[model samples]
Target: MTAAILLQLVLNGLAMGIIYSLPALGISLIWNASGLFNFAQGDLLTLGGYVMLSLFGKAGLPYIPSFIMTVAVMGIIGYALSQAYFYPMLEHRVNPQIILIGTVAFSVFIRNLVLVIWGTTPQTYKNPFGSSVLQIGELYLMPHVIWIVAIVAVLLITLQYFLRGTMVGTAMRAVAQRPTASYLMGIRNDRMIALTFMLSTAIAAVSGVLISPIIPLTPSMGGIIAVKAMAAVLIGGLGSFSGALLGGVAVGIAETLFAAFVSSTYRDIFIFGVLVLFLLFRPGGIFRASVSEKV
Candidate 1:
């Protein structure tokens, strides 16, 4: 590829990667803490996007406040879902495999619920950034793309700090590593698990808000994006934060380059095929070693 074309591709990749990474982070956090793969995560993202779209796009609320409201409301929904459904199941000592099925059912239920409530029609939200594009040298970018990158960076940094630098962060890490040990050490395991769900949902909601302006609002959007996020998490190494970020960027670049050079329709197929290869040969992911213990 030419230099200009390469630069543009990398930029496109980074923008898409940022969007993809947000949900991956959520998945990693939940998996690490609870040992449950939440299939409903993507639907949660869709719910967040539609909630914001409805409040701001349909209700004519101001952007800044509406955005805050959307995040807060989605966060609560995430926490509530965990508390109402996931946590009770865990407490009752239900089978992990069955919980996985429940999550899948939950995802389907949420998507169909959206369809029934909003009808089959797709909805569009007005972009707060408008149709502005930025140019640097031979590279061109959209204002929303810039927002996506910046927001992703901020969220990643914040999560890193939260996991590494704070008391709650330390407790969370301890719980992830050894829940029973953490409980014996006076860390509330149940609370930590709940917090994990809330945080995961919050991150998903943020991703939805950031990308909604660009992609439009639709019920089915989350499923595909969720798959991409899952690929990112698995490729990066399950339960590894840095791995998720790196994996997301890698997948984004791969997708963009493939679409630019190869066929866009085959991009996902090619990317997922590579993922299968990785699973077969390096299942522990790029950034982590295979471990017998949880996470």
Candidate 2:
């Protein structure tokens, strides 16, 4: 490939990587805190995007207010879901496997409900910035792509700081490490788990809104992206923030390069194949830590 083409591909990959990282981070946070694999995450993201589109595009609201409104609504929805379903399941001592199945069912219900409400037709959110491309040397970039990358960077840095610097964030980390001990220490375990879900879903919703300018909104879009994001989480490592970032970039680049050089038809299959290999060989994930069990 020519240098220009390669540069463009890298930029495209980076933009896509930023978009994918949101969901990967969401998955990691929820899994580490609650030990529940939330299958409904992607659908929640889709719901957020549609909610934004409906407010801004259809109802003629300004972009900034619409964005804020969407995030708030989705966060509340996530919190409600945790309180309604997962909280009761935890209280009843439900198996983790069953919880996973319940999440999957929730995902299906949300997706179908969206289909019923919005119909099977696809919709697009009007880009606040008109379709404009910027060229730097040999690389061509879009305004939306820059916005996505910047947003991802800001969020990642802010979240990392919050988790490391704040009391609540420290408490969350403690809960993830040992829930029973955390509760013994007077941390409200349920509230922390619910907060994790709310924060993660809000992040996912923001991602959907940012990427809506680039991709069309459909009820089923969440399913495919969620799978890719899960693969990213595994490839990066389960609980590592840096792992999620690296994994997302790797997947995005791999997909783009493969589609450019090989066949687009096999792009997804190839990515998933890589994920399986990672799981089979390095089950601890790309970034592994050794923990000693106390007697």
Q: Of the candidates shown, which would achieve the greatest lDDT relative to the real structure?
A: 1
TM-score of each: 0.95, 0.95
**How well is each residue in 130-165 modelled by candidate 2, as lDDT tens digits?**
688888877777888777888788888899988899
| Cα lDDT tens digits for candidate 1, 167-204 | 99999989888888999999988778888999999888
Reference-based lDDT, each prediction: 0.86, 0.84
List RMSD in Å for every model shown: 1.6, 2.3
Candidate 2 — which residues are off by over 4 angstroms? Answer: 289-295
- The worst-scoring run of ten residues by lDDT in candidate 1 lies at 286-295
Residue pairs with colliding backbones in model 1 are none
Could you tell me which 10 consecutive residues in candidate 2 have the lowest summed lDDT?
A: 286-295
